[model samples]
Each structure stands twice: as structure tokens, then as C-alpha cells.
Target: MGYKLNIHDPQDPTSLPPSTRSRLASGRRASESIRVGIPLDYNIATLQPSVRNAWIRTLKALHANGHTLHPVRLPATQRALSAYYVLAPAEASSNLAKYDGVRFGSRAEGIDGTPESVLFAKTRGQGFGPEVQRRILLGAFSLSAQAIDNYFIQAQKVRRLVQQDFDKVFAKQNPLLDDIAETEGTGDKVDVLLCPTAPSTAPLLSKVEAQDPIQAYMNDVFTVPASLAGLPAISVPVPSATEDQNIENEEYTPFAGVGIQIIGQYGDDKLVLDYAKELQAVARDS
Candidate 1:
């Protein structure tokens, strides 16, 4: 969460642009007491036992540090995974269409016919990886006239719902919203939302390859929702000592440490960084 400028000049901070320097100075200060929302029912089934334990400990530490903790449920975030996959691929297909040998990206050698024929097919097949190709194809299908209403349009609606879910929980108003009516929700708004970064720790490469593609996408469940809402989010790692407390037993200890994600409202980037610094200290002590 904290970034030390690695430049040779120690006075680099002073040389920064006015806005950048102001943000840096603000981020360096400790955050005031603020309400943080913890989703009591979200992603419960998907999280690993160790990750759940670490997340709980992090929340306890924050509560002990005088930060108010509130329980909130964001059910719309559960649909973000599917919506993101559809929308992301559809956008990628449109953006990357130019990379078909005629424009940017690598071109294939000695292909017969026009750029739209064998050349395009061969170029994309050789240049793009299996996953990229899969997404591109899926995207193309989703955007097609026949499937647009069912897939692409539905995904767009889901994206809006996901954004609204975050906006509802955030105490700060989203500047992008036109009116105050957009922020209404059931519970008291919170300054930030805390959750696990992923369902579990980093997985082994072999295990990853052996799993189904859907299972692989499940790793992104916790992160995609924040992205859909365009919120400022940081994943701070829990200290190894705290995360590996059960090392003596044959339990699943996260060697790399679990990541606790803190997500703040849009334009709350500085606040997010400040909170992250405090959470990092809490993580070390816990």
C-alpha cells in the first residue's frame, strides 16, 4: 500500500507536480476514524477456510483500532463474475479487431487471399493465445445480432446493477451520478468496503492448468465486482506470521499470504491508500 520512490534523488517528492505532490502528502497522513462495511453474506461459500479466518482477523484488528465496522450484504456482486466475462470479451473483440495482420500486432507470413481471408485467420491464430482467442470468439458471438439482446444487453444491465450496489454502500457520493436518488440503499453508508482479494491464495501452476476454465474464472469473483463499479481498490497482504499461524498442523497455510482488499468510492484513491497503510500495520500486529 505504501510506495517509496526508488529514484536516486531523495528530494523527488518536492519535484513532483503540484497535484501529484498534494495527493502524495494526503496519502501519507493517517486516516480519521471512518465506518467500514464488511459483507457478512457475500462470497461466503467461495472463500477458503484460511482466507475467511484471515479476513475476520483483519476486521477485528480494524475494529480494535477504533474504526466502526458495519455488516452489509451486496447480492448484486455475485452476478458480476458472469457479467464481466461477457462484457469484457465483447469489448476486447471490438478493440482488438484491428490487430488482424492488417493493422497493429504481428502479421502471418505467406498467407494467400486478402487480409480478411486466410491472412487474418492465420495471423490471429498464431498471434493470440488460446485464452485470448477463446474470449475473442465468445465476444464476437455475444455481440452478434442474434445474441446481443440475450447476452450483451443483459451483461450491460448487470454491470449497472453492480455499480449501484457499490454506490449504495459508499458514504461518499459518486460524482458521476446525476442526482442524489442514485445513492439510496437499505443500511447506513460506509466510507469503505473490506473483503478478501481472492477466494484463496495463489494456486500452483499445475493445479491451475488441471482445473476447468470456469473454475479458473472463479478466482476473479471477488475482484471483478470492484472493477465493474470503477472503484478504487487495493489488495493488502496479511502478514505471513498471522496468515500462517497453523503452520505446525497439516492445514492449508498460505505461503504467499492472503490478500485483504479495501475498496473505496470513486475518486477516493487517496483515502484508499491511507486506509491501506493503517490496515497493513494492523495486519503485521495481528
Candidate 2:
């Protein structure tokens, strides 16, 4: 393979996402980070108080370093988050159905049962953990003969709307589309989106174990919309505020740095990583 390059990374070089490698095929990393005001989406602001504080500080640092920051609102975030729960579990249920013992499931030999039906039940009962079992049931119910149209079909429609939301914001083309003529009509587009990675910092193991499993899913709130839209995103850790400067919250600790995420349009994974590196560099140098 004989090729020339404008930029390269040796540390985890070849493992780069395919989208990234192809972007570099243009023989350039990217244009300089612009002077445009970075948009801070409204949904991100409603995250845990500590996470928001971290974002505020990070933005302050950016402003201090001479970057304009703009605050914006995204109305589809709530709908998208709701739709992911439905779509992901529905897909998981269909995907996981292959685990029936005859072809692809763990045999639950420990259970004493005669008929094949009993074995199938035992295998599933014993093989899947509680949380996974719950999702499987929910997914099955959603896909059931009676509920398919009401739930699964509706969920699919929601998923497309979710994809449209990102397309308008990014302005970049979605590679999945064959014809770009019908793209979401005009609106402001951003080079990249900056937001918190989770609703809060990591929680203590004991607390996480004790809480309702569904509650834990909320932590993924800020990140799921992009995921549902099939966009590439990366989280970069920005230095935390000092004890005296930190916001006092029982859920957050001094050692927990803010997790800021960068998202780019589909097949724009390389650009997303570039922006994250730039933001992390600024944080480190500051």
C-alpha cells in the first residue's frame, strides 16, 4: 500500500474508526477551529447540578481563551430519548430470540424438565440476568401480535424523526441516505456539538446496586439522542474545579472531572475525534 498523509497517529493508529481513516484520505486533518460561537444545547443544561457546573466552568475557560459561546435549545431531545428506550429494547428482544437452546442457547441441564418446551423455558430463565430478562419481556410485549402496530411500528417512526433532528443541526450529509434532495429543510447547522456525556458523574457502586435499574438508564440521557441518530460521539474529560471552586454536591466528588462529549454527523467520526482532542488540549493547557 503506497499512500501519503498529512497527519497520522501512532499511539492507536490503525484502530481508528473507518470513517476517520476515509476522512484523512482527503489529505488534510481539517480546517482550523473557527471563531463561531459554540452552541450549548438546552437539554444538557438540565443534567445534574454538578455536571452543569463543570460545563459552565469549561465554557468560561473557553471564553477566557477567546472563544464565543452561544446557548441554544433542542426540542426533540425528550422525544428522542423516549424513543431509544422503546427501539433499543425492541431490537434487543428480536436479536436475543436466537438464544433458544435448540440452536443457540445455554442448556440449563440443572433444571429437571421432560418436554423440549420446558427446557426452552428453563434455559432462558436461567441464562438471562434480571435486567436483560426485563428488557426481553418488554421487547416481546412490544413486538407481540396485538401490540406490534401500536408499539414497535410507532417506535420505528419515532426513530426516523430522531435521525432528522440531527441532520438539521449538523447540515452535513447523512451517508445512509441515497438521495440528498429531500434533506430536512434549511436551519442553522453546527460544525460539532458539545455537551455533557451523562446526567451526572459516576455513582458509588453500592448506591448503583441499590437503586431501581431503570433509574440508572437516565444517566445515559445526554448521550442517547446522538446514538439514536447514528452519529459518532466521543467524551473527553476536562479538569475538575478545585475544592473551593467546586459546587457542593453529595453525588459528585473532587476527583470527578467533567465528561464533555463531541458529536459529528454520520461518517464524520474522524472530525468528532479531532474536536475532542482540540477541546482536551485547551483544557490541559489552561
What TM-score do all the candidates reach, one by one? 0.83, 0.80
Predicted structure 1: lDDT: 0.81
lDDT minimum window of 10 residues, candidate 1: 19-28
RMSD of each: 6.3, 5.6
lDDT of each: 0.81, 0.70
Highest lDDT, which number? 1
Task: Write model 1 residue lDDT over 1-286, tens digit each, in one string.
Answer: 9976622354665343543333322232455788889977555675776777788888889999999899887889989999999999998899889997786887878853575575578888888998899899999999999999999999999999989888777776676666456445636889889999988777777677788988889888999999989888999998545535654433344565888999988768778988999998998888
Clashes of each: 0, 0
Candidate 2 residue lDDT tens string, 1-286: 9776534446665454554545432312544543222434544554767667667776776667565555445556767667777778888899999997779966878653666565578788888999889889988888889998988788778778777767666656666665557555534555567777887777777778898867887777788888888778899997665642356566665566778887777767677777677788777875
Clashing pairs in 2: none
